[model samples]
Target chain A: MNFFACENLSAGYGRKEVLKNITLSFEKGRIASVIGPNGSGKSTLLKCMGRLLKPSAGCVYLDGRSISSMTDSAIARSVGILPQSPSAPGDIPVHCLVAYGRNPHKKALSSFTKEDRETVEWAMHATGLQDKRFLRLGQLSGGERQRAWIAMALAQRPQILLLDEPTTYLDIHHQFEVLELLEKLNTSCGLTVVMVMHDLNLASKFSGRLIAMKDGQVLLDGCAEEVLTEENIFDIFRVKSRIVDMDGSRAAMYMGVA
Target chain B: MREITDSDAKRRLMTGAAGLMLLAAGFVVSVITGTVDISVGDMARIFTGVQTDGMYHVLMNIRLPRIITGAFVGVNLALSGAILQAVLKNPLADPGIVGVTAGAGLFAMAVMILLPSFTHLVPPAAFIGAFVTSLVIYFLAYDGGAHPLRLILAGVALAAFLGAFMSSLTVLYSDRVQGTVNWMAGSLSGKSWIHVKMILPYTLLGLFGAGIGARYLNILMLGDDVARGLGLSVERVKFMLTMLAALLAASAVSVAGLLGFVGLIVPHITRLIIGSDNRFLIPFSAVFGGIIVIFADTAARVVFAPYELPVGVVMAFVGAPFFLYLLSRSSRS
Candidate 1:
C-alpha cells in the first residue's frame, strides 16, 4: 500500500512557484531517491512531504489521511525529516542530541521511561554511534556528525524517514557509508526512506527507485535502469552522460554538457 | 547505549546546592554591609526580636527590603535572559537586546514626568510598555516566522527608538532630571516593602511559567525546523516563551529600575558551569543571578560610601568588559 503520497502539490518561496502540480507516492517499505539539477525543486518537494513547507495547493497524505489535519506529534511519530545541513547547538553530546528525538514520545513533565532509553540506545547502535555517543557533535568528523544527526532522527522511530541532500559536503567514502547505512535500515527494519540526491550515480546505485525532476515537474520516475537513460539525463540535467551497468546497478557517468 | 549516569545528576545537584549556599551568603552580606555598617550581631538580635530602635528601623525599613528586591530582580532578569537565549537560539539575545528594558524605562519615565499623581501605576504601565514593545519586535522581526537575527535587529532598532524618546523627555523636563536620571541609570535606591510587594506577583508568575516551559526550551535550542520535526508547535511555543520572558524582564525593571548584566552574565556563567540543559540552567541561573545582584547592590551601597552609586553602574563597569571577553573568546573558538 502507498504509505505516503502527495496529490496535486504546488509550493514556492513567495509568488514564484517552484513546484507546480506535482503528484507522487511511495509504497510502505521502499527506498526512493529524488535526483535533479540544482533548481529543479527536489529539496522543495521533500520539504513539502516533511510538512516543513505548506503546499500552495493540494495535500500530503499518510496512510490515506491528510497530514495537515493530524497533530504535530502524530505526524512526527509517523514521519521523520532531516533537512540538509542540520545543526545542533554548540557542543551538544551525541547522546543528548539523539535523546531529543524521543520528545514526541514523552510528556511535558515526565522523565524518560525505560522504553525511551531503549529506543535511544537502538538508534545510537543502528547508526554505529555507540562508541561516540558521549562525544560532543563538534568533536566528530563530518561523517560521524552526519551519523549523529541520523541517529537523532532514528530515535523518533518513524515509519518513514526523509533526508534532503544528506551526503552533501562529505568525501565519497563517507557518502557511501551514509547511503549504505540507510539501505541497511530500509532492508532490516522495513523503514521507508526518501532522500534527495544530487549525485545521480549514487542515487541510482543505492535507491531501489529513482524520480528525476526538471523544471518543477517529474521528468522520469522508475527503476534506475529506466530513469537514468542517456536521453533522460540529457533532457533533465542538460548534460551528456553514459549509463554503465556495474554488477546489477546502473551508474550514470557524465561526459560533458549536452 | 550510554545513559545519563548517576554521577552527572549528582554533579548537577551538587552545583545547585552550592549555588544556593552562595546566594545565601550574598544575601547575608547585602543585609550586613552598608554605609552605616550593621554587624552580624545586630542582624541576629533584630531577627531574634530584640528590636533595638535604630537597628530595627535600618534593618526592617531599609536594608531587608532592598536585599529582597535585588534578589528577586536578579532571578527574574536572569531567568528571562536564559529563556530568551534559548527561544531565540542566540546566545546574545537578552531582555536589553529586545527592547524590554528600554520600553519599561520609557513608560516608567513618562509616568514619573506626566502622571506624577498616579505614581503608583508606574509598574503596571511599565509592564504594558514592555509587552507592547516585545510584541512589536516579535511581529516586525517575523516575515513568516521570527528568525533570530531579525528579532535581534528589530529589538535593537526599537530599543534605540525608545531610548531616543526617553532622552527627549528627560531633556525637556530638566527640573525632573535628577529622579529620571537615577531611574534611567537603573537604581535600586530607597526601595521599600511596597516596591517588593508590587513586583512579587509578576516575578512569581513569570518564574512559574518559565519553569514549566523549560523543557520545550530545550527542544527549541535544537533550531526551529528540528523542533517542529520533533512534534513541537514551534510558532506557538516561541510566542508563549517570548511573552513569558517579557513578563520576567518587565517585572524586574518595574521593581529594580532596569538592572543590567545580571540577566546576560548569569545565564552564560551558569551554562558554562552546569551545561546548557534548560531544566538545570533555569534554576541555576536564578540562584546565581540572585547572588550576583545581591553582591553588586551591596558594593554599590558601600563602595563610594555616602555618595551611593547605582547597582546598574557597578554591573556595567564589570559586565561590559566580561561581555567583550566572552565575545572574543567565542569568536576565537
Candidate 2:
C-alpha cells in the first residue's frame, strides 16, 4: 500500500502556481528520487509532498487520510524534510542541532526520554557524526555541516524522509557517503525516502524509482531503468544523450555529437 | 579548531558568576545612592518600613523608585533588543535601532505636549505608535512572508520620520519643549513610586511574554526555511515576538525616556560571552542590561553631582564607542 499520495495537487506562492496538477505516490520502504533541470519545480514538489507548502487545490493523503486535516506536529512526525541549504545562526552545537529533530516528540517541561536519547545517538551514529556531536556547527566543514543536518532529520525518526538537493554542497566522496547512508537507512529501517537530485546518473544509481518533473508538472514516473531513457532525457531536459547498456545496467551518457 | 580546554570552561563559569554578582551589586548600589546617601543598615531598615530621618526619605522615595525604574528599563530594553534580533534575524535590529523606540518617544512627547492632563494615556498611545510603526516595517519588508531589506529600510525610514517630527515639535513649541527635552533625553530624576507602579505591570507582562517566547526565538535563529521545516510557525513566531519586543520597548521608553545601548549592545555582549541559547541569553541579558542602566544612572547622578546629566546621555557616551568597536570587529569577521 502507498504510504503517502498526492492527488491532482496544485501549489504555489501568492498568484504564481509553481506546481501544476501533479499526482504521485510513495510506497513503503522504497527510495524514490525526483530529478530535473533548473526551474523544474523539483524542490516545490518535495515541499508540497512534505506538507511544508499548503497545496492550492486537491489533497495529500498520509496512510489514506487527508493531510490537511492533520496537525503540523503529526505531519512532522510522519515526514521529515531537509531543504537545500538548511542554515542555523552562528555556532550551534552539532548535538543541539540534532536535538531539535526530537522537538516534535517533546512536550513542554518534559526531558528527553531514554528512547529519545537512544534515537539521537543512533542518528548521530548513522550520519557518522558521533565524535563531532559536541563540536560547534560553524567549526565544521561543508560536508560535515550537511551530515549534521541529515542527522537532525534522522533524529525525527519519521517513516518518510524528503530531501531537496541534499548533496549539493558536498564533494563527490561525501556525496556518495551521504547517499550510501541514506540507502542503508531505507533498507534497514524500512523508511521510505524521497530526494531531489540534479545528477541524473547519481539518481539512477541510488534510487529504485525515478520521477522527472518539468515546469511544475510530473513528466515521467517509473523504475530507474525504464525512466532513464534517451527519448525521456531529450524530451524533458532538451539534452542529447544515448542510453547504452553498460555492464548489464542502463546508463545515459551525454554526447557532444547530438 | 581550538581545544575545549579546562581553563576555557572554568573561565566561562567564572565570568557567568561575575556577571550575576555584578547585577546583584548594581541593585544594592542603586538602592544606596541618592540626594541623601543612605547607609547599608538604614537602607535595610527602610525595606522593613522602619523610620529614620536622613537616609529614610531617600530610600523610601527618591532612590527606591529610581532603582526600580532603572531595573525595569534595563530589562525591558535588553529583551526588546533580543526579541528584535531574533525576529528580524539581525543582531543590529534592536527595537530602538529599528525606530520603535523613536516612534514611542515621539508619541509620548505629543501626548505630553498636547494632552498633558491625560498622563495615564501616554504609555498606551506610545505602544500603539510603536506597534503601528513596526507593523508598517514588517509589511514593507514581507514578500510572501520573507523580507530581508525591507525591514531595515522601513525601520530607517520610520525612525527618520519620527525623529524629524520630534525635532519639529521641539522647534514649533519651545515652551513645552523643556519637559519634552528632559523626558525625551531620558532621566530618572523626579521619578516617584507612582511611576514605578505604572511600569511594573507592563515590564512584568513583557518579561512573561519573553520567557514564553525565548524557546521559539532560539528555533527562529536557525533561519526561516529551516525554522519552518523544524515545524516552527515562522510568521506566527515573528509576529508574536515583534509585538512582545515593541511592547517592552514602548514601556521602557514611557518610563525612562530613550535610554539607548541597553537595547542595542547588551544582547550582542551576552551572545559573545555565552552561546546564543535564548533560554539562558534572555534572562542573563535582562540582568546585564539592568546592571548597565543602574550604573549609568548612578554615574549620571554622581559624576556632575547636583547638576546631574541625563542617564540616556551617559549611556550613549559609553555605548556608542563600544557599539562602533563591535560593528568594526563584526564587519571584519
Candidate 3:
C-alpha cells in the first residue's frame, strides 16, 4: 500500500494559489524527491502533504486514512515532518530539542517514559549527534544544527518523514551528508522519505523517484533517467543542461540558459 | 547524551528547589519585618494559638493577607508574561509592556467611576477590556501573521492610548483621585482577606491552565510552520494560550492595580536559571516572582519607616534598569 498520497490538492496563502490541482502518491519504503525551479510551488506542495497548509480543494491520506479526519496526535504518530529552516530557542540543548519530538506520544503532565528516552537516544545516535547532545543549538555548526532538527523528527518514530529543502543552507559536503543520512534511514528502517530538493544532481543521485514541478503543477514523475533528461530540464527550468554518467549514477550538469 | 540530560535535569531541579526556598524566606521576612517587628519566636507563638493579641491580629488580619496577595499577584503576572513570550515568540512580551495591564486598568477605572455600586463586577470587566485590547494588538500586528517586532510596536501604541485614556478618567473623577492614584501606582496597600479571596481562585485556575499548556508552548517556540507540521493545531493553541495569558494578566491587574516589571523580569531571570522549557520555566517563574514581589513589598513598607512607597515604585526602580541592561546585553550578543 502507498504510505502517503494527496489528491486534487490546491493550496495557497490568502488566494495566491501557490499549488493547484496536484495529485501525487509515495509508496512505502521508497525515497522520493520533489525538484523544481524557484517559485514552482515545490515547498507549498510539501507543506500541503505535511498538513502544514490546509488544501483549498482536496485531501491528504496517510497509511490509507484521510489526514483531515485523523486526530492531530494520530497523524503525528504516522508521519513526521521537518520544515525548511526550522528554528528553536537559542539556549535549548540538542537533547531537549530532540526530546520534544516525543510530544505526540506522551500524555500531558507525564514524565518521559523509558521508551521515550530510548527513542530520543536512538535519534541522536542515528544523526551522529550524541557528542553534542548537551551543547546549545547556537553553539553548533550549521550542518550539526540541521542534523539536530532531523534527529528531532526521527524521535517521533513516524513511518513516513517529510522534509522541505533539508539541505538548503549547508555546504556541499554537509548537503551530501544529510542526503546520505536520509538514504541510510530509508534503506535500513524502511522509512518512507519525501523531501524537496534544489540540487538536481544530488536529487537524481539519491532519490529513487523524482517529481519535477512547474507553475504549481507536476511536470514529470519518474526515475532519474526519465526526469533528469536535458530536454525536460530546459522545458521545466528554462535552462540548458547535460546529463552525465558518474559512478554508475546519473547527474544533471546545467550548462547555460535555454 | 543520557548523562548530559541527567545533569540538566538535576540542574533544573536544583533551581526549582532554590526558588521555593527563597520564596519561603521572602514570605517569612514579609511577615516578620513589618512596623511592629514581630520576632520569629513571636510568629511561632502566634501560630501555636498563644494569645499574643496584637501580634496575632496584625499577622492574621493585615500582614498575612497582604503578603499572600502580593505573592499571588506576582505568580499570575509572571506566568502570564512567560506564556505571552512563548506564544508570541517574542522575548519582550509582558503584560505591562504590551498594554494588557493598561487595558485592565482602563476597564477597572471605568467600573469604579461609572458603576461604583457594582464593585464586584470589576474583575470580569477588566478581563473583558484586557481580552479586547490583546485582540486589537494581535490583529494590528498581524499583516500575514504577528511578527515579534510588529507585535511589540502595536502593543506599545495601544498601551499609550489606553494609558492616556486611563489618566484622563482619573483626572475627570476628581473626587476619586486619591484612591485611583493609589490603585494606578500598583499598590498592595490596605489589602484585606477580601482582596485575597477575590484573586485566589483566578490565580490558581490560571496557573493550572498554564502548567497544562506548557507542552504546547514548547512546540510554539519552534515557529508556526514547524509547529503545524509537527501535527499541532497551531491556530487553536495560539488562541487558547493567548486567552489564558490575558486572563492571568487581567486577574493580576484587578487585584494589584498595575504591577509592572514583575511579569517582564521574573520570566527572564527564571529562564536564565532554568532555561526556556516552559514545563520548568513556568513554575520557577511563579515561585521566583512571588519571592521578588514579597521582598519588594517588604522594602516598600520598611525602607522609609514612617512613610511607605507603593510596591510598584520599588519594582520600577529595580526593573527599569534591569530591562535596559538586558536590552543592551542582548544587542551586544
Candidate 4:
C-alpha cells in the first residue's frame, strides 16, 4: 500500500503541461532520487509531491490522505522541502535560519518553546553545525551553507524530506557529503528521502531506488540495477550508456555513440 | 520554555530601549524649544493641571499636536518602508521610490487644489489613491511571478505616470495653489490637533499590522518556494503586506504631504544596527522614525529662525549623505 503517493498527477506552468498523468509513490524509510535531463519534469514531479505546486488533474496523498484536502500546515508538519536554491538573509546566523523551521509548529505570538530549542540543537548536532551556529551565512563555505540548509530541513523533524537539486552548486566532495548525510538520516532516523538530481551516476549510487523521467512522464522505475540499463538510459537521456558495477552499487556511464 | 539568556535577544532588547530613549529625548526637545522656549517646569505644570503661564495655549494647541502628528507620521513612513523592503525582497524599496506614496500625493493634491470645498476628505481620498495604485502595480508587475526588479520598475513607471497628473492639477489650478506650497514641499507648519486625529487610526492599524506581519516578513525573505515549504500562505501575505504598507504611506502623505526618503533611509539604518529580524526592526524603525523626523522638524523650525523650512528639505539634506556613508561602510564590512 502506497500511503505517500501521487495518483495520476498532472501539473505544469501556464500553457505548458510539464508533468503528464504520472503516478509515483515513495515508501517509508527508503531513499529515492528522480533523475532526468533538463525539462523532463523531474523537479516538477518533486514539487507536485511536496505540494508546492497543486496538480492540475490529480491528487497527491500524504499518508493515506489527499494533500489537497490537507492544509499547508498539516502537510508541512509531515514533510519538509528544501528547494533548488533556498536563500536566507546573508546576515542571519546559522541557528536563526534553523530555528525558522519551527514555524509550522508555532502558534502566533508564542515564544520559542523548550522543545523547539532542543529540536534545533539536535538538528545542529546531527548536521555537525552545532559548533558553527553563530556563524553567518555570508561567512560559511559552500558545503557548510548546504549542510546548514539541510540542518534547517532536519529541524522540522518531518517524516519525509524532499530536496530539489540539493547538490547543484556544491563540489564533488560536498555532494558526497550531503548524500552521505541523507543516507545516514535515512538509516538512523527513518527519514524517507526524495530528491531531484541531474547527476545520473550520483543519483543511482546514493539512492536505493531510481525513478527516471522523459517527456513529462516517468519512463523507468526500480532499483538502480534495473533502471540504469543501456536501453533505458538512451530512452530517457537520448544518450548511449554503459552501466558499470561499483563495489556494492551501479553507476551509468555515458558512451560516445550508439 | 524557560527563557534563557540569549545574548542576541538581550542585545536586541537593549537596542530597542536605546531607540525608545532617543525618541523620548526627541519629544521633550521638540516640545519645549521654539521662538517661545517653554521651560521644562512650565511644561510639567500644564500637564499636572496647575495654573500655567501664557505659553500654555501655544504648548497645547501648537507644539504638542504637531509633535504627536509628526511622530505618528514618522512611524507610518518608516514602518511602511520596512514592510515594502521585505515584501519586495529589495533593500531599496520605499513608498516614495516605489510610487506608493506618490499615489497618495496625487489624490491629496487633487482634493486640496481642485476640490477645495471638500478639503476634509483629503485623508481618506489619499488612502483610496494609494490602495488603487498598489493594486495597479501588483498586477502590472506580476507576470507568472513578480520579480523584485519588475515590481520596482512597475512602481517607478506608475509613480511617474501619476506624478504627471499631479503636475497637471497644479498647472491647471495655479490660481488656487497659494496656501499648499508648504504642504507640497512636505511641511508640518500648520498641522493641528485635527491632523493628529486624522492620522491616528491608520497609525494604530499600521503598528498592529506590522507587529503581526513581522513573522511572515522574515519567512518571506526566504523566497516564495522556501516560505511555502514552511507552510506560509505566501501570496496572501504578500498582498496583505503591500496593502498595509500602502495604508501606512497614505496615512503619512495625508498629513505630511509626500515626505520622501524616511522610509528608505530609516529602515536601512535600523537594519544595520538591528539585523534583519523584522520583529525588532519594525518597532526600532518606528522609534528611529519618530526621532529623525522630530529632530529634523525642530531643526527646520529653529535653525532658520523666524522663517520655517519644509522638514522634507532638511531630511533630504541630512539623509542622503548619511545613507551613502553607511552604504559605503557596510559594503566594505
Candidate 5:
C-alpha cells in the first residue's frame, strides 16, 4: 500500500477551490517533489496531505487509514510538517522550540524521557544545528533558522516529513545544504520525504520523483528524468525550453523558457 | 558572556531572595503598625499564646484583615494583568486599560445602588460584565482572525465608553457617592474577613485556571498562523484565553475596585526576568503583584499619616510612568 494517498481530493480556502480532483500516492521511503508556479496550489496540496487543512471533497489516506478520521495527535505522531514560515515566540531558544515537537509524543503531564532527549539531540545533530542549539530562532540567519525548524520537525520522529518551500530564503550554498540534508534523511533514515519547490533545477536534482502541477491539477507525474522533458515543460508551464542531459545523467536541464 | 550569565543568575537569586525577605518584612510591618500601633514585644507575646488587651484585639481584627485584603488585591491584579497581556498579545493590555474594570465596576455599582440588599451578587455580576465586554472586544476584532490592532482598538473604544458610563453612574447616585468614589480609587481600608473570604475562592479558582492556560498562552505569543499550524484550535484557545483573562479581571474588580497596571506592569517586569514561559510568568507575576500591592498599601497608609491614600491611587502613581515607558519601548521595538 502507498504510505500517503490522496483520492479524488478537493481543497481550498473558504469558497474558492485551490486544488481540484487531485489523485496521487507517495511510496514509502522515496523523495518526491511537487513543482509549480506561484498559485498552482502546490503548497495547499501539501497542507491537505499533512492534515493541516481539511479536504473539502474525497479523502486522504495514510498507510491504508483515512486521514480525516484520525486524531490530530495521532496524525502528528506519524507525520511531521515544516511550514513555509515556522515562527517562534520572541527569542525562544532552538533547543526549547525543538522540544515542543515532542509534544505529540508526550502523554498528559509526562516530562521528557531519556529517549525523547536523545531524539531531540539526534535531530539537532542531523540538521547541523548542534552548535546553534542554544541560540534563539530570531538571532539565527534565515538558513540556520530554516534548519532549526527542520530539526524541530525531525524531533517528531515521523514516518513522513512534508515541507512547504523548504528552501525559500536560503542562498545557493544553503539551499544545496538543506536539500542534501533531506537527501541524507531520505536515504539514511528511510523517511518518506515530500516537498514543494519552485526551482525546477533543485527539484530535479534532489527528488527521485517529480510531480508537475498547474491550475489546481497534476499535469505530469513520473521519474524526474522522464516527466521533466522539454515538451512536457512547455505544455504544463506554458514556456519553451531545451532539455539537455546534465553530466551524462538522464536528469534533464531546461536552458530557458520564453 | 560568562560573567553576564553568572550575574544574571546572581541577580535573579538576589532579586527573588530580596523579594522573599521583603515579603516577610512587609508582613511583619503590616502586623506591627496599624490604626492602633502595637509594640513588637507585645505582638510576639500575643503570638506565643499570651493575650494582651489592645494588641490581641488590634492584630486579630484590624491589621490582619487589612494586610490580607491588600495581598489578595495585589495578587489578583497581577495575575489578571499577565493573562490579559498574553490574551491580547499586547504587553499594554490590562483590565483597566481595556475598560474591563470599568465595565465590571459599572455593573457592580449598578447592583450596589439599585439593590443594596444583594451583597452576594457583586462578584458574579462583575464577572459577567467583564466576560461580556471581553467577548464583545474579541468579536469586534475578529476579521479572518482576531488581529491585535483591531482588538486593541476595540478595547480602547469600549474602555472609554465604559469609563464614561461608570462616571455617569457615580454622578447619578450622588447621595452615596463617597462609597462609590472610595471603591473606584482601589482602597483596602475597612475590609473584614468576610470580604477576604469572598474574594479568596474566585481568586484561587481564577489563578488555577490561569496556571493551566498559561502554556497555551505561550504558544499563542508565537502568532496565530503558526499556532493554528501547530493544531491548536486558534479561535477556541483565544476564546478560552479571553474568558480566563476576564475571570482574572472580574475577581480582581470584586476585591480592589479597578486597580490598574497590576495586570500591565507586573507581568511585563516578570517577563523581562523569567522570559515568556507561562509556567514561570504567571506565578512570578502573582508574587510581584502581591508584593507591589502590599508595599503600595503600606505607603498609602503611612505617606499621608492618618489620612490614607487609596492603594489604587498609589499604584497609579507608581504604575503610570512605567506604563508610558513600556508603551514607548514596545513601539520602538
Candidate 6:
C-alpha cells in the first residue's frame, strides 16, 4: 500500500486554482523535497498532502484509506504537518512546545500520561533541546526555536512528516542544521519527510528524491543527478544555470534570467 | 507547550492560592466597609447564624448578596474577555468594548419595558442579543482575520448605535426608566439573592466550559493553519468558545447591567502576572476579576460617603487609560 499519496488532486482558494490535478506518492522511510519558483503551487501541494486543504477534485489516500474518511486527529496520528513559521505563545517553554506535537495522540482535556511525557522528552532529546527545555520559546535563537517546533512535530511520533518552507528564515548554517536533523531522523527513526524547499542546493543534497514543479505540474521527479540537469533547470526556472560537481555532489549555479 | 514542569506547576498553585485569598479578602472588605459598618464580631455572629437584628438586615440580605453578585459578574466578564482574546487573537476584545453588553442591555431593556410580564426571560434574551452582536461584530471586523483595530472599531460603532436605541427607549418610556438607569450605569447596587441566582448557574457553566476549552485556546494561539494541521477542528472550537463568552457576558449584563473594564483589564492584568496558559489564566482571571470588581464596588460605595458612584463609572475612569497604554505598548511591539 502507498504510505501517503495524493491522486489527481485539484484544490484552490475561492476560484483561484493553485493546485490542479496533481498526483504524487511518497514511500515509507524516505525524504523527498518539492522545489519550484514562487506561486508554482509547491506549498499548495504540500497542504493537500497534509489534508490542510480539501481537494475540489480527486482525493488523498493515506495507507489505502481515503483522507476524507478519517477524522482530523486520526490523520494527524499518522501524519504531522508543520506549516511555514509555526508559532506558539512565546511565554511557553521549549518542552511545552514539543508536547503540543502530541495534540493528535491525546484527547483535548485528558491529563498528560507517562507515555506522553516520555515521548515529549524523547522528542526534545532527539532535537537536542534537552538543555533548553526549561527556556521559553522567546529566549531561544531562531535556529533553536525552529528545532523546538520540529521537536513538537516529532512528539506526535508521526510516521510521515510534512513541512512547508521549513528553512525559509534561517541562515545557511541553521538551514544545514535543520536539514541534517531531518536526514538523521529519516535514517535513524525511519521517518518519512516531504517538504517544500526553496534552496535548490540544500534540497538536492539532503533529499533522496526531488520533485520540480512549474505551473502546478511536476516538471521533473528523480534522484539529484537525474533531475538537477542544466537543461531541466533552464526550462523549469527559465534561468541560465551551470551544474557544478563538487566532491561528487551536484549544485545548480544560476547565472541570470534565461 | 506540553505538560507541567514542577516549578511551573508550583508557581501556578501559589498564584491560584493568592488569587483565592485576595477574593476572600475582597468579600470581607465589601461586607464591612459599607455605609453601615459591620464589625468583625458582627460578621462572626452573622456567619454563625446568630442573627443580630441590628446588623443582620444590612449584612445578610443587602450586603452579602450584592457581594456575591459582584463576584460572579467579575468572573463571568473576565473569562469572557479571556476567551475572546485568545479565540479572536485580539487583545482589545471585551464584552463592553465590543458592544456585547450593549446588545444584552438593549435586549434586557426591551424585555423589562415592552414585555414586562416576560421579565423572567431577560437572561436568555440578553444571551441571544449578546450572541448575535458578537457574531455581527466578528463578521464586520473579520476581513480575512479579526484585526485588533478593526474589531475595536466595529465594536465602538455598534455600541454607539445600540446606545442610541437605549437612549430613545429611555425617552419614549420616561416613567419606567428608574430600574434601567442603574443598568446603564452598570453597578451592583440594591442587588439581592435574586440577582445572585440570575448569574450563578452561568458562572458554574463558565468554569466548566473554561476548564475544557483552555487547551484548545492555547493551540489556537499557534495560529489557525497550524492549529488545523494538528487535526484540530479550529472553526468549531472557536465558535464554541465565542458562544461561551457571549453567554457569560449576557449573564452579567442581565444581572449587573453594562460593567466594563472588568472584562478587558482583569484578564490582561492576570496574564501579565502569570503567563497565558489559559488553564491557569482562566481561573486566575476569574479570581482576580472578582477581586477587582469587589474592590471597585467597595470604592464606589465609600468614595463619596453616602452618595455612591456606579462601578462602571469607576471602571471607565481606570480602564480607558490602561487600554490606551496597552494600545501604545502593543503598537510599539
lDDT by residue for model 2 (A23-122), tens: 8988999999999888888998888887778889988889999978987667777888998988786467788789888877766457779998998999
Cα lDDT for residue B78, model 4?
96
* Per-structure clash totals for the candidates: 0, 0, 0, 0, 1, 3
- Candidate 5 residue-wise lDDT, A80-179, digit = tens: 8877866666467788777777766765457779999999999999999888877767788888888888887788888998999999878998898889
The residue-level lDDT of candidate 4 at A121 comes to 98
Q: Which candidate, 2 or 4, has the higher DockQ? A: 4
Residue pairs clashing, model 6: A96-B1, A96-B2, A97-B1
Q: Each candidate's iRMS in angstroms? A: 2.6, 2.9, 2.3, 4.3, 3.2, 3.7
**In candidate 4 chain A, where is summed lDDT lowest over 10 consecutive residues?**
A249-258
> Which scores higher on DockQ, 2 or 5?
2
Predicted model with the maximum lDDT:
1
Candidate 2 TM-score on chain B: 0.91
The C-alpha lDDT values of all candidates are: 0.88, 0.82, 0.86, 0.86, 0.79, 0.86
**Which candidate do you rate higher for DockQ, 3 or 4?**
3
lDDT of 5 at B295: 85
Winner on TM-score (5 vs 6): 6
Please provide, for model 3 over B1-333, each residue's C-alpha lDDT reduced to its tens digit, 9 standing for 90 to 100.
567667878998888788888888998889999789798988889888985688899998999999999999999999999998898787777986456887888998898887788877876787778778988887888775556677778988998998898788877887876656666678888888988988898789888999899988998999987776566777778777877888788878887777899889999998888788898989888888889999999999999987888899999999999999999988998
TM-score per model for chain B alone? 0.94, 0.91, 0.91, 0.91, 0.88, 0.87
**What is the fnat value (0 to 1) for candidate 6?**
0.70
DockQ of candidate model 5 = 0.29
TM-score of each: 0.96, 0.93, 0.93, 0.94, 0.88, 0.93
Off by over 4 Å in 2: A247-249, B1-12, B41-51, B97-99, B116-121, B135-149
Docking class of 4: medium
DockQ scores for all predicted structures? 0.56, 0.44, 0.58, 0.53, 0.29, 0.56
Model 3 chain B poorest ten-residue lDDT run:
B176-185
What does candidate 3's lDDT look like per residue over A1-258, in tens digits? 776899999999896998989999899999899999999999999988888778899989887779989877778887889988888888889988999888888776788999999999999999999989899899998899999998988998999999999998899989988989999999889999999999888998999899999999999999999999989999988898888988878997789983
> What does candidate 1 score on TM?
0.96
Best TM-score among the predictions, by candidate number: 1
